[model samples]
Target: MFRSLLIANRGEIACRIIRTARQLGIRTIAVYSDADANARFVRLADEAWRLGPAPARDSYLRAELILDIARQSGAEAIHPGYGFLSENAEFAQACADAGVVFVGPPPSAIAAMGSKSAAKQLMERAQVPLVPGYHGDEQDADFLHRQADQIDYPVLIKASAGGGGKGMRIVERSADFPDALASCRREASASFGDDRVLIERYLQKPRHIEIQVFADSQGHTVYLFERDCSVQRRHQKVLEEAPAPGMSAERRRDMGEAACAAARAVGYVGAGTVEFIAEPDGRFYFMEMNTRLQVEHPVTEMITGQDLVAWQLRVAAGEPLPLSQEALGIHGHAIEARIYAEDPDRDFLPATGQLVYLRPPAESDSVRVDTGVQQGDAITPYYDPMIAKLIVWGQDRAQALARLDSALADYRVLGVTTNIAFLRRLAAHPSFAQADLDTGLIARHHAELLPPASAQPALPALLAAACWQLTGEARHTAHPGWRLNAEWQRTLHLGYHGHPLAVRVTHHADGRWTLTLPDNSQHVLSAERHASQLTVHLAGQRLHADCLQHNDALHIYLPEGLSVFTLPNPYAAEADAQHGDTHLKAPMPGRVVALLAPLGEPVEKGAPLMILEAMKMEHTLVAPGPGHVAAFYFAVGEQVSEGSDLLDFVLP
Candidate 1:
């Protein structure tokens, strides 16, 4: 066992690696950028170093700086957690050259599987089942289009040099092939500095199942079962679970054997995932192999009772495999939900801001939270917006899902918008609960999955009113006799998210207050006053609202967000309503990757007009019209602020 190791990554994965390393009596060193100076992972490590400024290129992605830190800290090994430099072959070789072990696959395996095109060729040569596609070396535009034609329509164009749904696009027809290919190449070049892309026949109703395999320096490799990651949006996984819901014993063995074969072909070691795209009819095709630890490794850990990180450490220390293929056992079911700093209601736009309050559900006997952030930490736009991975284990899939739903509801994160509410809805979705999932699940149930703004609950205004009215009258005043002692002294009017809410408060002799909502329902509330905040309780819900009194208006804090309220006024009229508005604005702060719609071009209601790249994926801004484009407010490559105009058009 190694005495000390350095984690060449940041955020939750870094924190996760440190936890296991410490448990094995290994001291851990953490590297951080300027933006993450006070991050949770930094505090968790036994030693820490500043890599560089906030930009990833200057910090987390700098292989030279990371290698230097590991050498200076006298660390025996460097663990490159997923993302950033984890799959970078050059970084792995650099660590080896510097006499430091990289706790992952050998550099030779990474080089072979690092490029999608190269991996496809290798897999085909090794007799592994591969998806039928064009893996040719020719990058000519016409030649690629010819290959797409040969493969027929509905082909997937993916960046050969990158993963993570970054440089990937699906074209449904030959008419859209040319443009989609150009866009994919441009993004691939910008993201990975490689403009090469490959075309493949798109599989319909595909379930993403991956096998977790581990090997040791002694050339012993074994498969540890599989995980189903079929729940996705924009080709990115949202939820994952181990021991696929209905996988037969035969199918499991076949897939596991194939995965192990692929690993042996590349001389793979440590923890890695071999992903496959399985059709509805049970036929599975190799997608690609992740050369490092995955974000959802916890699910595999729960089912197999294995510490994958610990395995990596042992393997890196030149140890032989402790167990064989027949020795591994999997029990029960486990599921993981990726909680991100995004707004599902707003087309799943990435949100950036300070985290006011992040209260993840406390871990219980079966519940776990792997997080890289703390309360008051800022979510910047420089990297992935994933906040944490919420994982749960149970005796079966049903129990795991039930626990996940409950955990999601109990989670409370404020300051910036998140997908907590959205995840809660997804777990309860009928299709999802039934395990009938695919890449198009989010699109098929688009209306139900992403409800309009009107679907959001209107409780903020009511809560604001309750808080405003309850705190308006001070218990003590400048004049001693200003206090009033009636059954009920004040009726307060509060607003929540611009909605009016009327609340009446009755203070009892015991100091607890009773509040009546606009609907005439009454509930008891407890108050705990502080210098900056006022705590209130109703039913089983407790809220800590910050008090800000300005211009006779009081603001109340609700779980959804904060809202302001004013004094009761019967004469204040409501504004006129217009519901059929169109011409979408920027959902959040992002850069325009391209302008798909030309000036004065007529478009359908759901036509793609432009693409906004934010947080990591490409979001196609659609036209909610059957009218001609009135104007284009921004051009390609332009950075726009949140709510900045992208297009202006009148609906037909």
Candidate 2:
């Protein structure tokens, strides 16, 4: 094994690599950008090196700077953790030229699989089943339009050099193809520096299944079974599971062999994943091969009882295969849910802010949490807003799904919105529990997955927030005659979502208060506070919750969901003007990608105006009401802050 290794990534993957490296008695060096100076991964490293500014291009993607750091730190090998330069073939070749081992496949293999079009062609040659598509080099608009015509409607335009769902567009009709292709190419160029694309026949009701394959320099390769990642949003996976539910043993063997064949064709050495789109009728087509360690590798590790990172390290050190296909076995079912700093409502726009409070499920023999942020860390706009990954294992699919829901219920985060509630709902849904999955599952059950407006915040939170306020202001321990002259009751206003709720609390001599609401609902509740934690007793049941104050809002972490309450400003305020204003502003911080309307174009109520890209997704701003574009403040390709005025319109 090498004496030292450098991790060329950040966030949870970096921290995860360090954990395994330390267990193997290896010293790890971490390279970080300006945004991650005090990050958890940097603090966990044995030695640290500064890369550059916060953006990926200035830091993490700089292959030469990383190579210099590895050489200076005496790291014999470099681990590119799953993003940025993970699949960069030039970086792999650079590592080889510097006499440092790249803990991944050969550069030739990466180059072949880096392009989706090229990978599909290679897989076809290897006899691996492939989806019907066009992979020609001519990227002209007319050529693509004609090819789409031949392929029929409902085709997918994918970036040839894309992964993680960045540059993918699905068109249902012929007319939408041109606009989709333009958006797809723009995203492709911005993300991969390549504007070329490939058109494929989009598969309906298909399940995304990927086989985990490993190879050694000795030409030995083995399959670590398969994972089902059909639960997705925007073509990116939200949840992943190993030993796909209802998969027969015979089909597993066939897919496994095909995966091994693809690996052998590329002369692959190290860990990689061969992904496919499997039809419900059992036919599968090759999608693309990830040339490095995957983000969801832990599910495979949990099911196969093998540390893939360790395999990568040992293989890079010239070691032979750890275990053969016959010796390997799937022990149990495992599930992983990616916790991102995003709101499921409002179209799942990514959120950014500091973590006022965070508490993950306890880790043990069954539950595990892979995280890279501390409680006070900030989720800046510089990178992906992933908070952590929660992994659970059980003896069967039912047990695993049950454990996943339990783990999600116990997870807590505040200040920044998250999708934990959405995940919990999906994990416990009857369809998901029965293993009925597809790429469009979330969109199919949108209304069922999200809580109704009435169920957004439960009634218990109101009592909890009020109790917390009473305790924080030291009113709970007031004099015995507190209510003697106050008409035996006191009313306080608690703001929830900017609306005030008048709570009437009637103090009783028995240390209990009768809480009343606008609905005339009354309950005798008692609360005891110990610092920021509170325990409320209602009737015969007891409940505990955490509360904090930040951003002029009271953040309450409840079992149902995170609730925010604020004491609205009474002396300083203005009447809302959004109802009549004609100015268009950005809802979030992002870069203006394109402007559709000219300065004097009359747009309909819902006509597309401009597009803003943020946190790896594109959001289009449309005309709120019927209006004519009067002026534009920011042009395309300029970075704009949240709430910045982008356009002013004249009401029609």
Candidate 3:
């Protein structure tokens, strides 16, 4: 359609747009911040432009800079890949004024539907079913409390300009409304620049179902079914699937019709999603309309076998709708897991580091991985820490879920912690397998779904580490008789993912080894090394091991996990505390949005200190103890590469 286009985003979505654009012989230009200068998306683009510093405001969110990049790169259009300026009406209007196509809806539609409060009002006038709530602009505390009382208890206070769970709070009792509203407004103001909010009845056990609608300039709109994104943490979706499990044909038709009506009423064009919150009783209501392509569009593409990005470009080029609602059909089930660089064990905190080793699950006909990082790439604190999106498809829901589980298990990432284990556990859980889940399911069964500490499987790894270390030491025995000494024994200290394991390997004269543990369990083992297979015999059981040596340290890969150990060389010096360089840090790598206190300020225990935004969600980092701010390493707009110190405090 167009000669070239600039992608106004980064990460997997930008890479995804590039893939489809290439398929259509369209040259793609990529814009990057300092953090993403070396990102895979930039390398994959036909041309690239440096936006600004790492902070989003100076780069991704700068509409004028993006427009200038498009002009300099000779890009005829701009694709605001979800988030950032994707939903900004002013950005859309700016593109229109610059005579460049904004591959999204009209600015008028974005302005009308961008605000949740305004969208709800317009939906009501368009005869669309809406959740009963207060949408008035009265910000008076008492007036809002009165409105909440009228709507009844268990109401949701949502930011009028928010999406992705920002500035949203749920109040269970009338007494909690005041505090919740205050907190919600503060966060709303900080995140969206809009403190205006609305109140709605909080639906319990709600399943978030949203209909995918695509339209063109011809005023023809078609529905692409729906995606169920109920599996979430803090209102951010973890997993998404299309053709929701147990969805009846009748309900699908009804929701699709309603979504199309909403789009047509606003004269919506291009790819957009109409989100609805469906109650347990099967009743659904219009929540809001996203004015651009969604992050989870791959799940929809997998089932429909249509390239949504290509459609976006074609629509922007003034093409008419290619398929009508009646012709569009979903052929299979698709599930997508948002693989984030986060530590699931530690409250799902976001993590940051150089990706020393990054191995996504092996690709196949039924699976797709949308990623934007490469090995040795650094995940900075200036952006979302989502490493990639894993999409799996199958003939049905059960098969898709199983494939997704296996895919997550095969994923491997090092240098920084990830939620792969957490995702695998959730996908394999019985409740998830049966699709009996909701937004709160993860929190409800958090203990059950958590990676079991007991199931970490370290014995095999310990044995490998011990065997490798002992064999290396025995190879250099000073005395010839020392090699044959039955009493030759040494303690091996091995390091696992991070924790240390003590292993005692005693090599006997008979060319066998006896391993003893702190738990008093003893195993006799024999080792046989081959080019490909390393076998270890323990007692009467024979097991395969993958063992190697790197930098004089023994490395062993077991079925469960990997282990590393140093040889018991008497001359080898003890390891220094320099290894502390890599320690526990903030969750999903993102810029510090706010510092709760001034530098050198004293704070009470549990007081909020800093707020970090990642994966489109904000995480408030609180003081661990009563302390005085020792240092503030981040400014309001400075991009501290993830793990870069946000601040430090001295304990009082």
Candidate 4:
């Protein structure tokens, strides 16, 4: 095993690699940008070095700087963890040229699989089944459109050099093919610096399953079963599981062998994943091969009882395969949910803010959380907004589903929106629990998975907040002299989701208190507070909640979900309400990539106006109604902060 290793990445994957390296007695070195100077991964490494500014192009993507750091730190090997430079063939070759081992597939293997077009060609020669589509070099718009028409409508436009759902689009009809193709190409160029694309016949009701393959320098390769990544949004996975819910032994063996064949064709060494799109009848087609460790590898680990990172290290050191394919067996079912700092209600737009309060479910033999962030850390816009990956294991798929739902409820996050509630709903959805999953499962059951947002807070949450406030006040202030037979009264004003509410609390001379809701409903309750936990008794029923107070905002955690209430600031509320639709503001801090509508041109409602790129995704701003953009506040390619006005609009 190598004595010293440097991780050429950041975030949870970096932290994850460091944990395994330390277990094998390898001194781990971490590289960070300015934004991650105080990040959790940096604090966990044996030695740390700075790369550059927060932007990836200046920091994590700088292969020269990283190679210098590896040489200066005396690292024997560099582990590129799944993103940034992980799949960059040049970077891998550069590491080899610098006399440092690259703990991934050989540069040749990476180059072969780097482009979808080339990979499909290679897979075709290797006799691997492929999805029928166009994977050629012709880039003319008209030519691509003709190809799509021939393949029928509903073709998938994918960037030949992209992964993680960026630079991907699904066109449902020939009428929309031109615009979709143009938008897809632009996004592909911006994301991967490659405008070349491939067209695939979009499979309806397809389940995404990927086989995890490992290879050693001695030419021994084996498959580690498979993971079902069917639940997705924006073409990115949200939930993944191992030993796919309904996979038969015969099918598993066939897919595993196919994955291994692809690995052997490229002389693949170290860890890699071959993704496939499987039909309902068990027919699967090769999608693409990821040439590095995957983000959801923990699910495979939980079921197989193997440390994949350690495997990577040993293989890079020229060791033989740890175990043969016959010896590997799936032990139990495991499921992983990716908790991201995003709003499910808003098309899953990424969110950026400080983690004022974060409490994950306690980890044990059955439940695990892999994260590179902690309380008080910031989820910046410079990197992926993933908070953590929560993995749970059980004896069967049913038990795993139950445990997943429970763990999601126990999670608590504030200061920024999260997808915790949405995850819980997804796990509990009838279609998911029954194992009837597909790429369009979320779209099929959108109403149940994503319900309409409530305009008012729940009664129980409001009561809990009021009781928590009263208990806090009682601890700090001296009690007012009570009248012989009169009750003391106090009114509190709170806001929930922009709606102002006022609750009246009447404290009786006795022990009980009365709380009147905005609807004039009354509840007589007794409450007790212990730190962040609050228990309330009302009308012979007992309710418990967790309250986290940050500044004037109170985060109330209930069994159903989380509710955030704040003490209303009259001045700020008025200002926010008055800022109407006269200007279009950026929802998040990002660079303006395109201006869709010309200035002073009247556009219909919902017409695309501008595109702002943030967190590796593009969000298009639209006209609220029939209006013309009067002026552009920020030009294309300029960065704008959250809530900054991007343009001024005048209603026609």
Candidate 5:
């Protein structure tokens, strides 16, 4: 084992690597940017060093700077944790030149699989099954269009050097191909600095399954079963599981062998994954290869009882394989759900804010949480918006599903929007519970998975918020509801989801209270508060909840879901109603990428006006109605803050 190790990444994966290194008695060194100066991972490491500014290009991707840090810290090895510089072949080769061990595949292997087009050709020679498409180097738009026309409609345009669902598009009709191709190329150039792309037949209703393969310097390779990553949104995985729901023994062996063969073909070493697109009839085709640890590797670890990071370290130390192919076996089923700070109802737009309050489910032998953020950390626009990964294990798939649903219900977050409620609904959906999954599962069941936000707060939420406020006031005042001759009455005005709500509370002499809504409906209720936890008795039922207050906003956490309410301001509401439609503001902090509509020209409703790039994704601003853009406040290639006015629109 190495005496000292340096982690070349940040966030959860960096924290994850530190834990394993500590167990192995290795001194772990962490590198961070200005944005992560006080991050959890920095505090967990034995020593930490600052790289540069918050942007990745200024810090994490600075190969020479990282190598210099490794030399100064006396690190014997460097672990590239999954993103940023994980798959950069030049960085790997630079570490070698600096005389530091790189805990990943050799640079030759990474270079061979760097480009999607070239990798497909290599797999062809290796006799691996491949999807039919154009993998040539023809970059002409007309040439690609002709190729797509020959392959038929409904083809996939994927960036030659892309991963993580970026720089990819699906054209469903002949008329949409040109626009889709242009958008795909733009994203590719922005993300990878390479605009080359290839087109392939888009497989409808296909399940995504990938095999985890490991190799050592002694030419020994083995497979660690497979994970089904079929439930996805926007071509990115949302939920994953091990020992695919209905995989047969014969098919599993065949796919495992094929994955190992692919690894051996490239002289691969350390941890890697070979993805495949499988049909319902048991036929599968090669998709692509990831030359580093996967984000969803926890599910595989739970089923196989192995620490993959430890394996990567041992392999990099020139050790033999831990176990032969015949020695490994699946123990139980495990499922993992990625928790992100985003709004699912608004097309999964990334959100940014301080994590005012955070609570996760209890961890046990069966439940686990992998995260690098604490309660006070902020989810900024400089990087990915992932909060954590929740993993659960059970004796079978049914038990795993039950645990997943229960765990998702117990999660609580505030100050920014989250998709916890949506995940709970997705886990309990009838189709999902029945194991009927595909890449388009979320799109097919969109109505059920993502219901609109409630127009008004639920009665329990309102009552809880009101009681919490009253009890807090009582702590400061001696007799808040004491009256000489009559019961004391108070009214609370709150806003939820843009709707105003007024609740009237009357405290009676018998130590009970009657609460009335705007519609005159009344309910008898009483509550006892201890810190932030509230125990209430309402209408012959007892309920337990958590209420957090920040400034004038109240967050209610219940068994059903989360509700956010703010103190109503009538003047601000009226002003917003008058100007909100005419003033176009940036939904989140990002850089202006393009201007689609011409200024002072009339455009129809739903016309795309501008494109903003944030959190590694593109968001298109559209016309709210038939109008013209009178002026633009920001130019292309300029950064804009959240809620900043970007343009002014005039009604036709």
Candidate 6:
């Protein structure tokens, strides 16, 4: 085995690779950008080097610099984790030229499979079943439109050079094809520097299943079963599991063999994923092959009792396959949930900020957390905002999902918004529990999945906020004479959804209280504190809630969901309301990618006016109502501050 291995990546995957390398008694080297100097992955490696600035193009994506660092550090191999330079075939070839083993497929395989159109053609020549589509090189707009019309409506426009749902759009109507194509092309160019796209027949209720294939330098390759990645948001998978819920033994073998054949067709080596789109009838079509490890690889690891990272190390060291295809069998069911720094309520837009307080569930045999961040880590807008990958194993899918839901509820993050609550609801969703999964699951049940905001906070959460306020008062004042043997009533001030929430609370000599809601509802409260938790007896029912007070925000976690209440700031609230009611300010921090509003042009309600690119996704800003473009404050490509006005318009 190579004595020193360099991880050419950052974040959770980098840390994940280091863990396996250390286990095999190999020294690990980590490379980081300026933003990740103090990141968890950096601290975990035996040696670390700074690549460049925070932006990926200046740092992690600098393939030449990474190769030089590996040579200087005497690293025998470089492991490119999923994103960044992982699938860059040119980098792989460069590593080979430097005499450093690239712990992935040979450059020839990567080059053959890197482009979607090329890969589809190669798969066709190799006799692998493929989805019918137009994989041509003609990039003329008219030509593409004709292809779309021929394929008919409800076709998928996919970027020829990228995956991960980026640069992908689904056109449902012939009239919308042109606009969708424009948007898809822009996104593809920005994401992969390639605007070339192909048209394909869209799948209705498609279940995404992928085979995990591994190959060694000894010309041996095997498939370690499959993972169902059907649940998605914005085309990115949200939930994944191994040993697909309804996969038959015969079908599994067929798909497995097809995946291996696809890999061998390109002379593949190391770890790669062959993804497929399957219908309910068990018929599947080839989608694309990821030339590196996948974000949801932990599910495969749990079911097969294999350390895929370790396998990569062994394979890169010219070792034979660790376990043959016959020896690998599904041991148990496993599921993985990707925890991201995003707001599911806000179109699942990525969020950026300090991780004020993060408490992931402790790891064990059945529960695991793969994270590149720790408490106080800042999630910047320069890269992907995935916080962690939460994986759990059980005897079956039901048990695995149940454990996943429980673990999600236990996880906590503050300072910035996250999708933990959304994840919890998704896992416990009735359809999901029954394995009624599809790629459109999130969109189909959007109403039930993302319910409207409640007008008032729950009684338990209100009590917790009251306790937080009283505790702070108690800690700050030296004398307790104000409430010492007497009852006192005061307004509990808190803010939720940018609105002030005031409730009347009366504290008595006994460990009991009377609470009145804003709407005049009353409740008798008896809360017993146990360290950081509380057992509240409210409305004659005993309920346990996890509560924490941090940085003026009182986070009360209930069995159903998490509610955060901040000390009421009337000034800030008024400002926010006025900003929304008067002019449209930037919802989230991002750069103005384009301006759609023409000067002095009258616009109807919901007219697209501008596009803000933030957190690596484009968000179109629309006119709230009929209005005339009165003024422009920011130009295209200008960085706009959150809550700042982008333009001012006169309502007609």
* Candidate 4 Cα errors over 4 Å, as ranges: 455-459, 471-484
RMSD of each: 5.0, 2.4, 4.8, 2.3, 2.1, 2.4
lDDT of 4 by residue, 102-166 (tens): 99999999999999999999999988999999998898999999999999978999999999999
Q: In candidate 5, residue 198 scores what lDDT?
A: 91
Candidate 6, residue 27: Cα displacement in angstroms equals 1.2
lDDT for each residue of candidate 5 in 363-473, tens digit (9 for 90 to 100): 998999999899999999999899999999999999999899888888878778888888999998998899998899999999989887777655654555555555553
Worst ten in a row by lDDT for model 2: 473-482
lDDT of each: 0.82, 0.87, 0.81, 0.90, 0.89, 0.87
Per-residue C-alpha lDDT of model 1 across residues 492-517, encoded as one tens digit per residue: 55444446555566667666667677
State the weakest 10-residue window (summed lDDT) of model 1: 474-483
Candidate 1: segments with Cα more than 4 A from true spot: 452-465, 471-585, 596-610, 622-638, 643-652
Candidate 2 lDDT: 0.87
lDDT of 5 at 222: 99
Best by TM-score: 5
The TM-score obtained by model 2 is 0.95
Q: Which of 1 and 2 is the better model by TM-score?
A: 2
Give lDDT tens digits, candidate 6, residues 289-323: 99999999999999999999999888888999899
Question: Candidate 3, residues 1-652: lDDT per residue as tens digits?
Answer: 8988899999888999999899989999999998888889999999899999987778888898899878888889999999888989999999999999999999999998989989999999988888889987778989999999999989999999887777899899999898789778877876677889999998888899999999999889889999999999878899999989889999999999999999988889999999999888898999999999988999999999888999999999999877887788999899999998887877887777888667777898799999989889977656778899999999999899879977876676667768877887788878889999688889889998774455223466555644564455434333324653347777665544444556666778787877776575777777777742477777678887655554445545554444455444444334323223222245445657777777677788778877776644567777777776667766765544544656666774
Query: Can you give the TM-score per candidate against the true fold?
Result: 0.85, 0.95, 0.86, 0.96, 0.97, 0.95
